[model samples]
Target: MDPPSSSSSERWLWWMDDEKKHSIADTIDIEKSEDGEKIDARKERIRDCMTVLGGFLSIMATGGAINSVGLLQTHWENNQLREYSPQTVGWIAGTNIFLSLFVPVLAGPVFDRYGHIWILAVGSGLFVVGLFIISFFDNHSAAPVTLGMMISSWGVLCGTGYGLIQTAVPGVICRRFDRRRGLANGFSSLGNSVGGVLWPMLLRVALERLGWSWSMRAIDGLALVMLAIGNGLMWGSGVPAVGIAARPEPESSDNEKNKEEQEEEGREPSLTWGQCIRDGARCFRKGDFVWMTASLAIFQFVVMGVAGTLPSWGQQQGFEDASLFFYVVAVVNAGAAAGRVVVGSISDSLGRFNSVIIVQTMVVIVGFGIWHNVGTNERLLYVFAALWGFSNGAILGLWSPLVGECVHTPAPDHIHAIIESLRLLTELVCGVSRLCDVENFGRYLSAASSVVSIAGLLCVPSSAQILGTLGPDIHVIFFGTLLILSLMFMVMARVTFTGYSFKIWRVV
Candidate 1:
């Protein structure tokens, strides 16, 4: 009745149980027992929902646009940029992809020191403004889109905007939700898939009737609306309305507990930039964290190849119509949307690392078995797109939750001391349970993104060369092989974290 005052494990179980006991009668009983506590809990739940909504809308604008790059590439090559080679055009997309990921290195630390509101506002402005500027440079205009124009607007401005939004959205989620983090992230990530499907369809229709100039503007208008609503909801939502109690590490000493309480009471000093950098650096030292980053980086390379080139490969196989490529992109994103929700839900019970290992196997299978063999058959290509999208979506959606787990995991060497430090850090930064150090999460996320951005920068351009010099068949083989290697790293990460003991299968 009075919010569980028992041990941390029992408190955690109580929260889970309370979630299940959802009924009007139960609500009435809770309110009757403690009006103030019940009201606070209700407010917290509402804020959590708002945070998820904000994340979904924000991701739809940013990540969803990124997902639609393949469609944009097809448009550019066919119409305005037909004179250039695929490899050359790829540099534009590569630049966008690179900035979208790489700018997070700066955004993450800035987010920790500042907050999310201004970051979201600035990012949304840049992204929308870039889109508007690009519309004027469309083939319909006097000054058609040039390499410099494309790179400057989409690559530099929009990409930097995306990086900032992406960093802030997840940081807020990590602070608010703990046990249900995977599910929350999954729901938020679903926005990208939805955006992927919607953007292509809208662009296809607009391109047919309105032409390229208005099509870009139309989507930019929609993006502006979505981003505005997202920013409004996300502002001032980082700190949880109710304190989520976390079980202290069993090894924590009384002094450590005292320090944690003091930090929770807002006595902790403002973290210096050096301290922020040092904390993020510590993540690299953990075997599991390092292995996990490598796994994600390699798999990201695979994803970039598939997302950027699959439609082009279809065009090469005699399906030249842009309309059909639109359908292909849509189907893949539809499958991805389903996968994010389904996989995120299951990861809570099955374990984050285990869920990735399972899904990534399918990624490998689809890459080698399905995509490699599909040549001229339109139906087979569609099938491959769907399967690839679904499996790949699951793997991509798990990265945030996996990173959260790694940050929370006790360091391999220090054990007790690191646990205490992390606990203190969590309370000091987020005023929530032992999920992750919210202030430092951006940097860890940035570290992972650093590797991913490199993959993004190279995968499309390099794959285009492979497509030209060799063939789509050889490109598939290369992509599939990378997936296999990444899968191995995933297993290594799991083992390194849980160890070789019987506790290997423990819900990690």
Candidate 2:
């Protein structure tokens, strides 16, 4: 039952050492777990569930609410602030998005070292402060006001509050469930979907009915409600019970053998400012990391491209209501929520890497292209948004689980942190700046998005079969047999290629 201390490289120390397993399970005190010492689990599932609910709310409150900017650019342009360069205004969001990713690794580790109570409280304050800044700040300042405000709400405050909760909630529920990890994660991821559904509509109504400031403050109110509930969840039920805290037995001696290799590598560095730069460089170097990040980044780029320009694209093609934008965001978020649960559950049965490759391929073809084309047809436009929404929603949730698969047999902590870190780096980028006027720029944006996403998809893990090299035929064949193969890997991580032996790739 003892884990091999010989290998402790990938964050799953439990798999490597007997004592480390205690930290993940019930033996440690939630309070004591923060101080480089093991403690105990509270054994409270109901409260843990509440913590997850709170997390869902917080993510929903913040996740898609601010993404409304692509839609908001028009208003900003029409306002006196029309002088604000697209890049300059983008810094507001870009900063928010970037920091929201980066600051969290440090915070997540700290939450591991400390606890969620203070982190949540502080993060909630930042969220409120951010909301106030957005609601009240006039962009008349000589400096970029939107940029400044986003950093406050989006970067520092949301990063801190949400970061704390994001780390804490799963830690809590994970302690509570063995049979339901996917369901737990899925349930928690839904908050954003719920918010995605509500926020845009609220933004529209409030802008016309309550005005920008009030509408934003109204968002603040909603945040407060979510946080209050989150507080209850963290405070009451975030730890595991005693008996369940025991170290889990390995599935086989092979797990121990894997642990032996890991113990030699040690833990991930507490990434300093320099580590961030290196991560970008390293992301390029590691084949798996490079391909994975590109795949995910292209997904986001497409998302931004679609989000920013889709309405215009729809308008251009003569399906003119701006209403579809919000609906798309909502549907995408909802689908993402569903994707996380379903896909995650599949990962349990299938391999994580396989499920993602399969799902992402479908996402590109069906969710983005086919669905998009159909949307252009008189009736399918709205349906297209709904379809895209479902697929996109799953993409974000896929990160953590995919990370779990990619770096299997590691200490869960380290694996989780790395996954989160890469996400942060991507969010931090300045991105290619937009030049033409907003509307025209949108068309260029979506086209560029499509192109990039297609390029990203070029390296689908097993494309050598048909194209002989990573190329267009591979891209064209996206929704076909490869998808089934990818899905097959989920259930049966084995290659079915004829004449080719299974030794090479059946288990990846």
Candidate 3:
């Protein structure tokens, strides 16, 4: 007899194996029909492009604004909230940073189930409205901007909106692309960097020429346009038909159908609220997950801590030209944008966990070697900003993708909950829809965010208080120690992930 075709041979093997049953149908590779495969490949590429483009635009508006908090801190202190102490004024920016990360805790699970449309809509609306409200008050007006107004409009509203948009962008990207996930996230994140560069320049010019009212309104208008177009493109971006992508879907025999029916009958009808909490808690049982969360939380603290107080530290360093501070913010973000793309691409090849170890080491070296010594040298300050931004960009770009990687391998569980719940919580540390499915990336991401966002909330004000009480030199050491702490946690996470293997070349 002639040898069977490759597809037929695979099917024969699958049929012969009784232990290899799956509830979901697999993605069929119609290799016998070349035309069908070509069409599917073409369609998949097109969809991926649309999603990336949409993510770029949305993240530009959200991430760009969030990254610009350092600039805002300097502006408010000099113009509107000048009378307030730096530590007090830092609260406004701190609250904004806090909400931007924290609100995602709620938005993540919602995005996993319902898709990105409604959440993005709500996020876009809140974002624009916050800026619009802020436009009405400035120093020259009868009703000047107050700390309360800034906190409510800028901090709470804009931050919450950004949290949703930020979550949705990475969540969809992770779902669509697995192997090239780091590249996709890095490229789309360029929007934030671009926004970071552009927003500072735009605000500086607008503030000088048009005053605060018009400047806020201008950003509000631009954000609305960018977000609207982005929302349209991301309409179809959500959980796809998840299964074994290489396996062909075969016609079910009578016996196979009966077996599936019996399996379905044995599953629970529904998962209760208590079960959901229990499953979420189980995710923390993994040492790798816990270490990763600790590292990210410290990362958040370092980022917000620096952004909140960097401008004030510059002023203290005796920089006479205030405009230079704005330029520094722009340049830092420019370096960050470059870093996200470069290091992000590198992570794809170098392994995400390995890249983390490398970048964090660079951060610690720069933090002590350069940043600690740059006193009055403007050139050194600029160099530090560029180098720090580049290294820090990797942290932001790789974080969600790292979570995606960690959540891919779920531990065995014997829970009797609904099939949906089990799929969503296979590892029970970070929620995965199935053992390795991308459907519930949001839940995994949210679980990680919840653990880290508190750092964002407290770090800014705390940093300012430290700067006030001790001085620039002491503050630098404080933040540097935090970086070391973060690096230690990342190392521990890598060790746990690798099962303490001595082979360093292994791709995590």
Lowest summed-lDDT stretch of 10 residues in model 1? 241-250
List runs of model 3 lying over 4 Å from the truth.
1-48, 140-145, 172-183, 236-276, 408-443, 501-507
- Provide the overall lDDT of each model, using Cα atoms, as 2-decimal numbers: 0.77, 0.50, 0.77
Local lDDT at 118 for model 2 = 66
User: Per-residue lDDT tens digits of candidate 3, residues 224-253?
Assistant: 999998888787665442222212333467
Compared with the true structure, model 3 gives a TM-score of: 0.77
lDDT of 3 at 126: 92
- Deviation (Å) of 489 in candidate 3: 1.7
- Judging by TM-score against the true structure, name the best candidate: 1
Ranking by TM-score: 1, 3, 2
Question: Please, what are the lDDT tens digits per residue for candidate 1 over residues 1-508?
Answer: 5547444334434545555534533555566669888888998889889989999999998777788888887777777777778888788788888888788777765665566777788889999988988887666233235767887898888998998898778777877799998668768878889988988888789889998888889889989999988988887475633222222323456878867875776434345668856766666756677889999999888787677887787777677565887888889899888787788778989999989998998888888888888877789988988888898788887887788777674433333665557545644674423224554555577678777889889988887878877877788898888999999999888866653222556676
lDDT per residue (tens digit) for residues 84-120 in model 2: 5543444444444444544455554455445556666
**Per-residue error at 205 for model 2, in Å?**
2.0
TM per prediction:
0.77, 0.61, 0.77
RMSD of 2: 17.1
Question: Runs in model 2 with CA error above 4 Å?
Answer: 1-45, 66-69, 73-75, 78-80, 138-147, 150-156, 159-161, 175-179, 238-286, 308-319, 371-378, 409-508
Candidate 1: regions farther than 4 A off: 1-48, 140-145, 174-183, 236-262, 266-275, 408-443, 500-508
